[model samples]
Target: MKIYKYKDSVYCDEDLSCEYDNYAGDLYDLYLDLKEDNKCGETTRYYVCDKYTGYDEPEELIEEEFSDLVIGEYESED
Candidate 1:
């Protein structure tokens, strides 16, 4: 399970271990709560999962679900 921390929020992959539908709601709530406390710009966390595979469980799934999210444009291959 890999967590990509973006400038605004985090992005993870939803798999059998991590269901987006279930977590998304709670995550949104947390986002709102955090926004209320922190006066910074609002950002949203997103889960990228396979539409075919109903497995949306753990945060680890993000590695296989979406690799692109981890790779930054300015990051070197080395």
Candidate 2:
């Protein structure tokens, strides 16, 4: 399946962290904890990379299911 890959320097940790893969989904507010804590945060810029994996579980996949905003690839991380 397609997923967002972290490609930011530092600010990614501020807003993008904690947002789940399904965070792009809608079930979050329906059942997850911190129901009242729902609010759109600042729109921080982020970089993106496309990666495909067949594994049911990926390595870089967050252990706690977090999100981190990123900056797009201006200069290659390479």
Candidate 3:
């Protein structure tokens, strides 16, 4: 799996065959909990890393709050 760090959150990129939806949900939940606990930075940041290539453009990353659908792209295999 590829780990991308954007601001305070880290996104994991996994293969298409892998269960990315479940993982994304889990990560979002974790992010929420962390935010509530003040574990995340004030920026409210997150990332979208590729699991296979472990590659993510700096511009592709997102931070400061995001929609569930927006995050879904990170989980996408394509």
Candidate 4:
């Protein structure tokens, strides 16, 4: 997995078996950005995930956020 800090938000490259929808991270930051700019809707979903689970629903993903987690070393491109 590749993690990128782009545009004040952290993005993680995900292998979700899809070509287009392959990134998942910084969801909470994005929600805050949208809310701060008054661009979010009432039905908009919010999340705070630091790990990947390959789940489709937000509720299930959030549930597995902290289970059996491991820290990995990620080198920066600076």
TM-score of each: 0.27, 0.15, 0.25, 0.25
Worst 10 residues of 3 by lDDT: 50-59
Candidate 1 wrongly placed segments (more than 4 Å): 1-3, 7-50, 71-78
lDDT of 2 by residue, 21-46 (tens): 33332222211222233322111321
RMSD of each: 13.4, 14.6, 11.7, 12.3
Tens digit per residue, CA lDDT, model 1, 9-59: 444332212423323222233334334554222214333322333224333
Clashes of each: 13, 14, 2, 0
lDDT of candidate 1 at residue 68, scale 0 to 100: 48
TM-score-sorted candidate list, best first? 1, 4, 3, 2
Off by over 4 Å in 4: 1-10, 13-25, 43-78
Decoy 1 TM-score against native: 0.27
Q: Compute the lDDT of residue 36 as modeled in candidate 3.
A: 63
> Which residue ranges in model 3 land beyond 4 Å of their true spot?
1-25, 41-44, 47-78
State which candidate has the highest TM-score.
Answer: 1
What tens-digit string does per-residue lDDT give for candidate 3 at 1-78? 233333444455343325433343233444554456554422333433222222132223323223332333443435
Q: Tell me the lDDT of model 1 at 52.
A: 38
lDDT of each: 0.35, 0.26, 0.37, 0.37
In candidate 2, which residue ranges exceed 4 Å CA deviation?
Answer: 1-59, 62-68, 74-78
